[model samples]
Target chain A: MNIKHSLLNIFQDNPTCWQLILDQALYGYLISQKNSPENFYINPALQEHLKLLLTDFKSEEFSFEIKEPLEKSEAKSIKTEAYFFLNGKKIASKKAHFLSFSFQQEEFYIAVFSSEKITRANAYQKTYDVGLAEKLKISEKAFQNNFEYGATGMALVSLEGKWLKVNKRISLMLGYTKEELFKLTFQDITVPEDLEKDLSLLKRLLDGEIDHYQLEKRYYHKNGSIVYAILAVSIVKNNDGLNLYFISQLIDITEMKRAEKRIKKLFKKSKEQNERLENFAHIVSHNLRSHAGNFSMLLELYESQLDEEDEIITMLSSASSNLQETIEHLSEIVNMHNSIKNTMESIAVLPVAKKTIENLSSQIQQHNLKITLAVDASLKVKAVPAYLESIFLNFISNAIKYSSPSKASFLEVNAEVEDAFIRIDFKDNGLGIDLEKHGHKLFKMYKTFHEHEDARGIGLFLTKNQIQAMGGKIEVESAVDEGTTFSIYLKKTT
Target chain B: MSTLKLTCIIDDDPIYVFGIQKVMDVINFCESTLIFKNGRDALDNLSSIIENNENIPDVILLDLNMPIMDGWEFLDEFIKIPSPKKVYIYVISSSIDPKDVNRVKRYQDVKNYIIKPVGPEQLSTILKDFKEDNFS
Candidate 1:
């Protein structure tokens, strides 16, 4: 048979034959070189010797095959067994190849064999065939895709304050396109006030002193608006354990920040309102008790002073009237402060002022006041009906009460729209107050600046409280005896 | 028992002042009376009396809410005056607030807090206390 065809036939029959031949070839070469023996061959008588050789080699089985006829070999040989036995058990039964060579025209034959399982050896070799580079590239692509399309904004910034890479979400959050963001650094978009804090955190990260940090900071958007975000950053290192870059994650929190501000404002406003109410309560308690205590004491005196009956009676009546007036004043203040809600309406200012003036017509005529009404007939304001009537009555009557006695009194009522307010000015040529002496106490309850018996000190106090409850304000400009202008600002009804 | 040599009244309300004056006369509560509209006038008058070596009032009835220099401010300034006599001050105020009542404790010169209007009987009782205590 042809040598090439026989070798191919053996390989097709048992693919494990090549591994067996390579192992045996190495063992045979080492044994022959180390022993330095004469020419060696296999024979039936040397079969025991080959078994001994196999035992020395620590193999469980052995097999051999040759393409040339056994008779053509000049060296000693044995009838080649397809299976080799060790200790009375057939240990080797796989087909193997043989090599026939001549040294000085004497032929020699060497057989290759193995005793191990074929399947286990092939599994060990297959493990090394996997391409690690291709596997790494596939996994890296998956991670990169996740980072680029994440919902939260992610970025990698170098130690030199430059943005190396930024995800799509960061560009969208800052109102900039990806190309525009790449051209800018993190410092360019940071709010001026928040840049210092962000830089310090980054420094800490670069020093490897902290693993990560988070802070709420403001960033400037491309449109020049503020974007609030909770920024979290961590350090990533290179193979040499040196500073590489920073990985930053940002979450938008602008809406939540606005809600927090609104809540704080409301809390402050309510606190101020509560303080005012407490002051009002103290005033009521002090004023009312004083008057009632005086009345009771006077009535007690009336019993013992029967001899001066007329005088005692006059005193008692005056005390009673004073008590009545105080009670009325307290009630008016309580009503004004308590009726702040569900009572406001759009009332025509001209009609209200006219009616108020009509009610005080007798007082107006007594003062010899010339009244000029410049208020537009269609002007309206947001106020409670009774409060509007009371406010107008107080202003008109106050003008008459303090009218100048040296000259004929002149009164002017005018209204003009200003922004969201309807400003009504009640100008009068009256005995104006020395505001420097009494300005601080002008709106304080029971504070009297004038010596007039009817001043009662309650009109302006009530007027101020009522206007404030309706979301309005009152201001007075005056010089002593020069005349006073009381400007009332009320919310205009549209 | 000796009556009060002189008594000072510092208040702004005319009605309360009138009632107190009548009650004092009916009971002859003091030998003489000195009245002032507010704390500032009382402080000025008392300071002058000290300067002239005149006799200061044995007792002072002070009101809390006055036009100028209220009772608390008066007490703050009054204790610093170098006077020969120790004048007892009684706080006569219409305030029933516990805060005002508590504030009176801060003044060591204030002897008592009387609520308005001081009745005739209450005045007689105060005079009797002064007589028994010999204005100590």
Candidate 2:
């Protein structure tokens, strides 16, 4: 029989025989020279299968050491059971047939064998099972260690809220021993106000509406103190989809909750104290003004009765006026703080700026300062009309008062609408303040930078307060010798 | 030399009252003058004057921040009285609080609001305006 035909017939019988030969069995013919035992040829498919099976097997080279003796006696072909070894280790054993053929007067041995038992070796499979079992044991220990000793409060709770297992951190968080915790259900220590919410979240988790849930809740400790924690819970279901236990983690936040409450109380107290101070200031200013008014009235009556100009009378008049001005300023500040929310309206900025400029036109002319009003006609801001007027008057008058003596002085007022605010810039070519040295004290009351006689040091302070009370702000950029620009931001109206 | 008729000053401060009275005398502000210590005193006396059909003051200068019944309370009570004659009320206060000035605008009977330390010039202007208003 032709060997090629026989092999073809074998493959035809089983369509997947080649696949089985490559994966489950190694089938290849080997050529060997008896004199040179290392001269062996292995097919590429068998080399590929050996590469998978043997850890140290090299793919390009094959050295087959046959230990079983072959007898070349009866026929030109021989059939026998044989074993193949590499480096004294038997890799495969199979039934083999050898045919000796002479071509060109040179002797050669061609052996054909196939083995499927390499894959089904009991020792190899047993060793693999042992390695897998060892890996599983190590991973299970790691999980157990993390569950018992993790920093966060961890627990395994049954479907009925009974504690099946709990970590040390969980026991410490609830002020309960591990044994004590296992006896009590999670509901037993949960604060009554927080239980309903936690249970609802758990129900959603169990229904698979959510895979897990996080809640900020309160629990009662063994010492009867409240325990605040942020809890994260996940359900652990069986492979068959039945309800099992729950894996819950809690991080204690009791101190944070207490700190938040303390801060809230402190804020309330400070607000009340501030209100009281404002009220006291209002009363004092009112009473002082009344007395000062009486003094001025009495002085006026005395002056009218005198037939000649009296030095004392002039002194008293100036003193009383000064007192009146100071009292007025004080009352203005007190009233500004007290009447904050009321009297606010959308006021056209251009008209107010123009009116202020018109009111101080003579002062501008006296100072030889050129005033430019570039405020938009349609720009409006949400502010009290009186406060807006005062703010404009303060800025314009300040610019005029502090105008540079040497350079050509100009006060250019411009207004433009910005996002959520109307930014009015009062750019002036005046003697700018030394913002580096006096920036912190620029807006403080009674802190005048220049030696101008009219610098009462109250204008900028009142201006800042008014701006802030109207939910606005003022920013100033200045250099000592250059110029100052005051930018006012007010809430825009439409 | 006096302008027309009765004028009244209601203030708690004696110095203010005396100074205003002297000024009224110098300006010949009225033919007759009435002075009360506080808002309650003025309200009571004026109500009786209206009841008796006596000479009611042509103008009332009401001072706020008094001891008994402040000007606001007095205005509330006085405006409710059904009087035949019109009583012009002016709220004069030492308070620079705009709240008080804004509150006076609510009373239709209140003719004006004036800050305190009323000098001769302001007083003369007020009298001139009052005279013109009455004659016109």
Best by lDDT: 2
- Candidate 2 lDDT tens digits, A28-105: 556676556666665444454444445457523435655455554325657665555666666656565676555456
Model 1 lDDT per residue over A394-476, tens place: 88988998998999889899999999999999999899998999889988878887788887788899899899989999999
lDDT of 1 at A178: 76
The collision pairs in model 2 are none
Docking class for model 2 is acceptable
**Can you write out model 1's per-residue Cα lDDT over B28-96, one digit (the tens) per residue?**
888888999988998998999977879799999999998878988888888899889878789998775
Best-fitting candidate, scored by TM-score:
2
Per-residue lDDT over B16-130 for candidate 2, one digit per residue giving the tens place of the 0 to 100 score: 8888877777778878779998888989999999999999888899998898789998999999988888877888888878788789999999988988888787778777887
What TM-score does chain A of model 1 get? Answer: 0.44
lDDT of model 2 at position A264: 99
Calculate the i-RMS of every candidate, to one decimal place.
5.2, 1.4
